[model samples]
Target chain A: MSSTLLRTTPALRGALRASGALKATGALSSASFVRGKATLPDLPYDYGALEPYISGKIMELHHKKHHQTYVNGLNSALETIAEAEGKGDLSKAASVAPLLNFHGGGHINHSLFWENLAPASREGGGEPDGALKKAIDSDFGSFDTFRKQMNTALAGIQGSGWAWLVKDKSAGTLNLVTRANQDPVTGPYVPLVGIDAWEHAYYLQYENRKAEYFEAIWNVINWKTVAARFEKS
Target chain B: MVSLNTVWQYLALQSPLQLHSTMMSGDSFNLIKMGVTTFALPALPYAYDALEPHISAQIMELHHGKHHQTYVTNLNKALESHIAAVAAGDVAAQIALQQVIKFNGGGHINHSLFWQNLAPAGSDETKLEQAKELVAAIERTWGGFDTFKNAFSTALLEIQGSGWGWLTREAGSGGGLRIVTTKDQDPVVGGDVVIFGVDMWEHAYYLQYMNGKAAYVENIWNVINWKTAEDRFLGRSEEKNEL
Candidate 1:
């Protein structure tokens, strides 16, 4: 392996584990062994579970096709990098870093996304209780206001992207941020809740009415999962 | 296209008729050069569907007619306001226009280079001439032509979102060729001269390629105009020597 890949792979795996998204999915094997290959994590619930809010078709395609492609792409990129490294070509390995960021980000984001949602039943779409609720109130004035801000941000995405409710771990405060395309929420914030605004996410059901999709998603948001992410972060 | 000297002359006269005549004669470059700049969308060098199979007609049409046109329009609008802000000495307004200028200006610049960099498959330009010094530079930097192509394609596919992958002549770094990626419509702003660029934006290929960006990147190699790249690389090199 290239010296860079050898040094960076373990650190990247550490960051992915520390991200809490992989842990939330319960699919990541022990960090010691899981270095380069990234597999698609199975959805926490059945495909049809998040019905009415997110249709079975969207869930099935998003997971099996979209997320799976990223997993495949990530593994392929890793293999290419390893091959380049074997030849002692560090620049060739460096060139594929963006592939790593995109595919690895897709895996991490979708893994969190599947867990971040649930059917309206089973504690899916209601107001948060306890500490999570207090944090939301403290961060954005009130839950209603936070919802409004997040919806506006999600709707305003010009192209394929995601809107996130992330926690600034150091400050212990929640912040709303948006990422273009499959970019994962990195840096000081730990992603608490992420809403995929990619057209493929809601286009079949909602069509051009992205605002409606954004509004409906609130009904199926797994706040319990979000709270767990926040607590862990 | 109007020469920079024509723009200087037109600015002195500031005649509406002079401007209209220049524009009617297909000299929009003067307008771009003048502070009253209005950038028109450049006509595609080839047909909308010229590079078929490699790039679908629909993708090319939408990408050029719609996407590129939007950038041209927005860039003109932004520049119009920006000129006024500068005239008024409004520092805040100038600062606020920075993002708009970078996004749209970058889009316009990048897309313009992108269109010229592509040719219909089977173009005579595919085979690099040994006489072309740029070919030697590319070989020296990346070991061989195939290796350079692989590195460029790999870098292009890896872009996380809407961005561009570029083959730039790094004048500051002794005129070597470098592969770089820029997020969004951020033009190659560093001291490098962009020789060729590929749009990694989904709009560039999503209609046909769907999520198969790697396929799109790989296939683009069949249509690249190496002659244009060689010209750009050599042009930058000559300019550096003149300095």
Candidate 2:
């Protein structure tokens, strides 16, 4: 790396920033986007490290504000869900179901997204090796096939939604399923890999057509984390 | 994996004054008439940290207070002189300044469009049901809403570079479902009327997804204000003429 970039680098800043979830930054800092007690997730790396891939600005807008809103909304909705469930108010809970699902799902998806993404030099966001590749081949015929399938499935989602590669514990396999909006995976599975199909997930850059963003995000894949997920499953 | 090396941050820090004329604008705006950065940062639609988890607060601060603001500031400067040139008797200067004016101007315009494109994740409007007509139109034109998303997403995914992928509709055209990519600084409005636009320019994404444009696009959906989008769609009928 160039000394110029290395000089103004970010270090330990992510952890410090994550700790900031509990406090208001300035007089204008908003507590509205926060609802429940969950803390903000620190970025895996500095804001600029993802440069050339993700801009520092988009990252700032997307992570700090966008994801936090979901976290806050999820916390708020959960309170209602719990109260309704506690009272055995299934119908009421059902009424609030969309909120829990969308916001909670948004929180969950963004949390996973932050963890899955990383800078290029790190082992975080890069191409998979060995077993992950082999699995990609066995399941989808080839990496390209897997990519095409993922993009198609993700783009094919209607309205607000998500596309996921969930690890079905029962079948002992990964399944690609697209969920409408924040609908959770109501099955005996874990998300091996997933993509958030929301406009804020991309829009500022990729715009109306989501396919391009999906195809391009492959560059920063933290395949190692995914491999770990596969092993855990 | 798509190569991250392929995408680079293109920051045109050169003042628009060079590209534009030397004259200035006396026209008043919503801002102060005096000293600033010759550019002012744009305001974010929501509070900072509104979209968390999916996006980080630090990223938002820099993205909004820094990146988007730079574009807005630069655009204003570019336009200040271009408008001045036009006011004077400099047709050639105005013509030559068009590209810079458009690029920076479009950047500001597109980013402004983008700021509202999202809502707090999970902010669906159950109280409002105005999106039905647009949804119905999608089903009619693209076979189904699902099919339209597929085609639209495909257009976005397959675009070669940093450009927008939009679903434009005209009076005669039910829906121009196509994926269009603009080279650096070029943004094509979806409809002549601009139902809505996406800012695929790198400054928009370089913060979060880096060169992983696909991931950025997918995440954008979480915050997409379908209601607003639906409104844009509703304002313009597929087969009706604007005139």
Tell me the tens digit of each residue's lDDT in model 1 across A11-93.
34643454442332212332223234566777788888888888898788789988999888776776677666657788998
- Best candidate (score: TM-score): 1
**How well is each residue in B62-103 modelled by candidate 1, as lDDT tens digits?**
778877788778777876775565555555775676566667
Task: Specify the poorest-scoring 10-residue window by lDDT in model 1 chain B.
Answer: B2-11
Every candidate's DockQ is 0.18, 0.02
C-alpha displacement of A209 in model 1, angstroms?
9.7
In model 1, which regions exceed 4 Å deviation?
A1-39, A44-61, A69-105, A118-148, A151-161, A168-173, A179-190, A197-233, B1-37, B80-93, B123-137, B140-143, B172-174, B236-243
Name the runs in model 2 displaced over 4 angstroms: A1-36, A82-91, B1-243
Clashing pairs in 1: A99-B158
DockQ for candidate 2: 0.02
